[model samples]
Target: MLFNEEIQRVFKSDSWKKVNKKLIGKMLSEYMYEKMIQPNILSEEGENIEYSLQVSESKHYHYIAQKRLFDSFDVKWTTIYIVENDGRKEADSAIELLVDLQDVIGMSSETAGHLIKEMNSTLIADAHLLEKEAKRSDELIHEDYASLEGYMTGHPWITYNKGRIGFGYDDYLAFAPEQQKEIQLSWIAVHKDLASFQSVEGLDYEALIASELSEEERIRFDVKVKQHGSEPSQYYYMPVHEWQWKNTLVQNFPEELAIGRIIPLGKGEDRYLPQQSIRTFVNITNKDKHHVKLPMSILNTLVYRGLPSERTVIAPKVTEFIKGMAEKDHFLKEECRVILPGENASMNVNHPYYTQLKEAPYQYLEMLGTIWRESIYTYLEEGEQAITLAALLYEDHHHKPYVESLIDQSGLSTEEWMEQFFKVVMEPLLHYLYQYGTVFSPHGQNTIVVLKDAKPHRLAIKDFVDDVNISDQDFPELQGLSSEFKAVLRTEAPEGLTQFIFTGLFICHLRYLSNLLKNNGLMEEETFWSLLADAILNYQSRFPQLEERFKLFDFFKPELTKLCLNRNRMVDYGYSDDDDRPHASEFGKVTNALAAFQLNRTVGSN
Candidate 1:
């Protein structure tokens, strides 16, 4: 798989020009609405009629629409045509008819809106999946090729093409018939399933090598060899379960040298089973590095063994290490940080947990590490510290600071700061929470609010944890964790989860939005109550379970409004610094002021 830069380059190449054209045409027609004006002449005394004037302006309403279309499509056109005709009423009618025609042709406003949303969603999902697949494919290909190369160097006489193995004339002539016979007999004796071979008569080894042996002679030879086989031969018959030995033999041998003595790769105390391999190559040149020795096939297996498992999530430590490296080197932040924990660890084949969870920690970590190193790390900067932090905080991706050093440095008035804060940070976050069921938001620790030119313009959510509990049936893996950890982590099983969500909402989102509103002189109690109502209404549509769990609408309606009003009162009564509760009259006065602000804003606007 190619790198992200290469993929993007391909996307922008001349071959994609056709796709761009259609995309641009669709974008323009969708956003560039024609405002057709129909001017009708009205007589003061109803005495005379005059010709009407019609004007049309084909103006693009949203800069975002234009920018997105241009960036995605790279269209060639710069200008669009606009027509003006006589008679205002006629022009209005014509414009309406044109809009209807566009709708009939599937270019309607509603259709375009849906398409745009879907396109954005598809792009994000595809990019993520492609990166994942590319990493996996690359690791498999690299390991397989390395193994294959080592095998070829060890057994030069064994020709391998397109993953198939064949013996050449040199291999056939390398050993004498007597030696081959002894080797075959040794193999049969070592494996005793071929006891029926005791009935076989004579074996013609020399005639078999020369292809001059009779069919009966070959059959008898195969039967006898199966009784005591040692030598490796493509023609040797074996049970289906025993075929794996062929792969084991080729893989265990080192390239470019004759097999001497076999040695176990690991010590007895190690948890993994020991495998024997023949070391052949004593000296081999590496083209990539003049001073480095080419690795023997036998040694190559060691490298493969160190790879992470493919079933469990990557260990937090491994993820952090990779992330740190990437950050120091200037890797793409978004692409480098997601480390799946399940694919890096290993599992014991015989363990009950393995059967229950279908994974092991070590195996999962290895797989995760391999993927991160090959794919995400490639996109990251060579040595980034944040990548390390990201790995360490993989489980809690949303826990980050809401303010940065830059914000402190920027010397803006509190009111101006709040306006920018709400626009740039709070608005987008509220939208996300409302849409995606995201509980984590811009809190003091979970966000970094970067300020530029005395304004909070950039917001980054640090340690954002997107993982959530749905139901046990939906994600059985949650059952694998200890019950204590499960209690802390589970957001779907108990009543306590509701308090957690409320803390995330009220203490995090509401608090931040409230602070910004207070700073901006917009913290009226009525305004706060209205905002809460809007949030609840929006939330209810997405999470219907809330209606059943808390009867939230009925139980919290009065309190929610009261909380907003009281908070606003605190700001209005010149008692903002006070931590203690105030009198009822003071609270009432503040609420009255809040109500007046809402009343004035509504009536004055109309």
Candidate 2:
């Protein structure tokens, strides 16, 4: 009865069926790409293929799909049908297909059961997205970055992307990014003995607090801290998500609260909006203020959206390391002028019991921490706008891509716009990988594209605490790195390091953009990929001295290991509470689409 109004408004039968069909199409396409399903080809016409999959003796699914490069499929959702002994009907249930494929895909019953909840949650979110007052691509192109994120759909590849396990409907309405709700953050005081605060060389706790909180709010918070019989100087003030404080900290840290080691200090004066990541918040009251990242215990995408204790402790150091490189490199500082919005400060509070317990579940250890990242607004020049790379994949209610609107507004042909896009995004990423033996997981959310006159002008990469990785191979650039950094940051082999860019950016994001553009008749699929290949090659030509490193981190190999996100949760790492978080699963190898362009370049030159 409480959510009767919401249920009536958002959960219409027609909307459910429509969102389910779209999700079914996504499941079929992604499952095929991951090699989880191999349907027999019924017929073929050019790049279009008709396939039939038999789930049971009498149950069959038939659909026509456009076969894209990277072994991906774009299934025509309306064309999908389920054939049974009785008759034939439109395929409209994603959960039904998921259950039917459980045994076929070797999913355990426990995993299947959990996946059902996640899939249903995803469906509810999708229905709300359908019912919300949607924006057009043209209008959204001019919107500010903070407000624009709410219009986006979640991850392009993952099926259960919005499966926020810990959220009730009330929490979703209050705090979900798509809800576009702005609320003041709740502050907590942790005794200095139990909390650790770190920051860049020039900034400290006092300066950070002064910048973040108004004098009146600080006084009120200090008075509350004193009421709990603790000196203001003996404690560190940390901003926390209201949901995290209510659901996670109260139950987990009861002893600390009872002893007055942790005190609730009420809400701050500034209002903030949650971003797509859900854990990060942007200050809506003051655009230039630092964006706050707090630990939320929701299970979304693959892992709990909590900041690991080790990463939080070392975040500022990582910021200094990355920003220091850009300060010294002439290309990064002057020519390309790439932006790195640093995670300049952080506060981490480890659970007393979890810290003492060996091999405790990771979720328990990461329950309390905060990272303060420099605002993206601080870096924008006049006539410049910043949007996350994910915005490009967004489709308006009319199914027009946001990127297409930007291209139209830029007064550039699709090819010209895409060329500038690749140069802006790839040059900085490649320079970091080839020239300096470093890489960031430049996935949609982590990478930001700065646009000028509606065309990409530069790149901004963030989330250094979680995403930045280094090459395992010894390189002079990394020789001076401290052992503390070596312990906190992940190190990868040559191919593994290259996968961060190749699979993270090209395969995960650009492939979808290429498909969208081709389907919309803006550009051919081959031309789209060829332009990206050209961008990488041009960067290589500029830095011939890094030829050996280029080969070591080659992006044009004939095949590379295929990473699967859905398969990771459903087949390999189910709902187990493990000491470490789950990662993307590696299935068989996938043919490299860029390799063909490289061959073409070689033959044309010869």
Candidate 3:
């Protein structure tokens, strides 16, 4: 197959053109909002907004965007143009947009070139996925949870959403979530020396493995292990990403393979569909089986898609602590039915070299691990379904938002549907914040929206160890939580923890949802923000005793710390192939849309 032919086709196709423009528009708008570039604002009258940025004296990037609430941009895809000083106009491609803004964002030549490559893979992946026509609103409305999950698009806020930098074309086809392929992971036997498996009380190593494999497969696996002269008692079995085994581990540690310390035990029987997060897989064979999250050493988006060895050990412990807290709280258990899908078990293999090197970056220490998380499907009731919160904002081929699809089916007015929607999502989140000073980054992908009859139900939160955080203040509630939980969970100040909810739930997820609502004329942008305020305030009025906790972490603070994702990429090292996840850069501020609306509501009452 000619590589260039395929590449050119994806780049030039009508769908690719639309997808690329949307991506470019998003990158330009977000980077500008993050203060990476100062665009000359030409005009703003209601939604009719125009801006131009000087990439250089000779070149300019121009766009007409409908300004959404919180100053987000919904750039008109067809209306973007790159104007040359020589009086030539060119339609913007994904790569061209990155190159144009690279200098403006103060990125080095090296970073610019690398970012272009990232865009190349991203566009290529988009090309492969975008060819499929979008389903009708009715189709998406009736879509099964798993199928609907596949329909949901990439990160609502990120520009280089599909940049799986470490993947080759073949790897992209086999492992990337967009491919919708069933991946059967290869198992590896790690001698007792290098491997450590941690688990919550009930979920042991044997049970977790048995749940994923049939009895015949388990017998076959044990037979293969015995033929290799290894006993189950002596070595721990860990599931390895098949691609990671061939591409990384086998080559990196030939000594371990030769010494029979790390022996491959062939593939497991279960077929898994890669969830939206790329590394996390949902068991398609048995939906109730735990979601297997393995470390794939690909550098994607902001970090290498690898799990930290240190955190892996404590993941189950942390999950247990959070689970106990959720079940024990009346608001969480009785009212909202919040489900914290426990990270039941995890296995981490210590790096042979990185552990010895004091200053090595974190990803090197994170290259190999697995976290077996309890599946939310295990807890779903009859007629209940769960979809990624990202799907709520998803626009199908016919440009229909999933929420609107649901509203139509529920036979409820838009306001009632949306009110119910916000209550279910925000109630548990606010309960955890005020009742227990706990915070989880319920970003679009991490948060799951459970529903029945296309109406909002409750939330099922996952990705515990990495995504969840706790308050620095020692609440009485956290008294008996294990020392491992205390150590593993990041203790941030009340305000800092507030950012997890403010930035994660509000900016990362709700901002785009708000745009979808406003764009479709389902609701005004201001009303959407007001509804969010109403969600939190209504939750607040129920537990008056937690008012101090609410005051401690004021959501109504005038400004929020802007998480500059694109700017974070542009400056500094531009990212390492293997390093700790970079710190979020606070570039600038936008008016707290929630605070603004809440203040307006209070003033209106008086």
**Which numbered prediction scores highest in TM-score against the true structure?**
2
The residue-by-residue lDDT of candidate 1 on 1-606, one tens digit each, is: 425653564344343433233233333332221111122332222322221222224221111111111011111122222233321111112123234334333354653343333333223222222232122211212221112112111110001101111212232122111011111111111112211111001322233223322356445545554444333242322111111123333342322012222211111110111001111011112111110011111111112112222111222222333234334432223421323211111111112232245333322222111111111112223322111111111111121222222133446543444445544444334322332222332333233343334354444443222223322322332244445433433344332233233333343234334433333344533455344444344444544644543242131322221112112221222222232222211111111122343344457669
Provide the clash count, candidate 2.
0
Best-fitting candidate, scored by lDDT: 2
Ranking by lDDT: 2, 3, 1
Q: Looking at candidate 2, what is the lDDT of residue 503? A: 87
Give the C-alpha lDDT of model 3. 0.80
lDDT of 3 at 480: 72
* lDDT by residue for model 3 (275-383), tens: 8778888888888888899888787778878898878999988887788887777778998889888998999998787789867887678778899988888889998
Prediction 2 TM-score vs. true? 0.99
Cα TM-score of candidate 3: 0.96
Stretches of candidate 2 above 4 Å error? Answer: none
How large is the C-alpha RMSD of every model relative to the true structure? 28.9, 0.8, 2.0
How many residue pairs clash in each candidate at the backbone level?
71, 0, 1
lDDT value for model 1: 0.26
Judging by lDDT, tell me the better candidate of 2 and 3: 2
lDDT of residue 439 for candidate 2:
96
User: All candidates' TM-scores?
Assistant: 0.23, 0.99, 0.96
Every candidate's lDDT: 0.26, 0.94, 0.80
